[model samples]
Target: MSLTSEERAYIRSQSLARLATIGPNGPQVRPVGFVLNDDDTLDIGGPKLRESQKYRNARAHAEVALVIDDMAPADDPIAAGWGRGVEIRGRAELLTLDAPPMAPDFFSNDVIRVHPSRVISWHIAPEGQARDIV
Candidate 1:
C-alpha cells in the first residue's frame, strides 16, 4: 500500500532506519541515521567514497528497502500492543559532494537519496493486523 503524508511524516520523525541493499554476495543490512527532507526525499549520510560494500551495491542496483519502527521492548509484554511500524520500498540514488543544495553534515560519510515507490505502515492493534495507512 502507498503511504499517506501523515504516516510518512511519522516515519520520518523516528530516530533510526534500517537500510537493505543487495550485493553480489548477498543482502546487506545497516542501521543508519537519516532525515526526511521537505522535498519528499529521504537523505542518508555516510561516507561513500570509501570502499563500502553497501554503497557499491546501491550504486549498482538502486533498489532498496527501508524500515523504521518505534522502540518496543520484548520484555514489556504490552509492547506488542502498541503497534507502530513503517516500511518503504524505493530507488536509492547516491548523492555526490558536488550535488546541489547539499547538506553534507546530515551523514558522517556519504549520503543516499531514496525516492519512495511504495510505502506500507501499521499501527497497534490487538488482532495484529497490519493495515495499509495509505
Candidate 2:
C-alpha cells in the first residue's frame, strides 16, 4: 500500500492540505483540496488549476511535497507536540485534459497527480512516537 492504515485515515479525515512546488524564483506553497485516488496517488484539482503557478511549477520541477496536519490530543498531557502531522514527498505530474475523476465540488477537470515516495508522520504514535513509511 502507498499509505499505512493510520496515514490513510488521517488523509481522508482532512479536507485541506498544503502543496509545495519549486519554480525559477523559489519554492511556492499553497492550500489545495485533494483526493486520494484508488491507485495510491493524490489528485489535486480546483478552478483554473491549469493556470495556477503551482501547476506550471509541477510541470517543470516534478518533485513536490504535500503536508497535512491537524490538532489532536497528545499522549502527554502537557507536551508541546500536542498535534499530529504528516508530510508526503514525491513526484508530481500535471494532468490537463484527461485527468482523473473528481468530486462534484471540484471546480475544474485539471489535476496534479502526486505519486508519493516518502511519508513522514509525527505525533500519531500510541505515545507520540514518529515513523517513516517508504
In terms of lDDT, the best-performing candidate is: 2
* Candidate 2 global CA lDDT score: 0.82
* Range of the 10 consecutive residues with the lowest summed lDDT in candidate 2: 73-82
Candidate 1 lDDT over residue span 25-124, tens digit each = 8899998767777666787666443367778889999999888888544553434536577777889998664542334543444577788887776663
lDDT of each: 0.70, 0.82
lDDT of 1 at 111: 71
Measured by TM-score, how close is model 1 to the native structure? 0.71
Question: Model 2, range 1-134, lDDT digits (tens) per residue?
Answer: 27777678778888889999999899999999998877778988888888999999999999999998888754444334467878999999877645435564656888998999998987655554577877
Per model, how many backbone clashes are there? 6, 0
Supply candidate 1's per-residue lDDT for 49: 35
Off by over 4 Å in 1: 47-50, 72-80, 97-109, 124-134
Query: Model 2, residue 131: what's the lDDT?
Result: 76
**Whole-model alpha-carbon lDDT for candidate 1:** 0.70
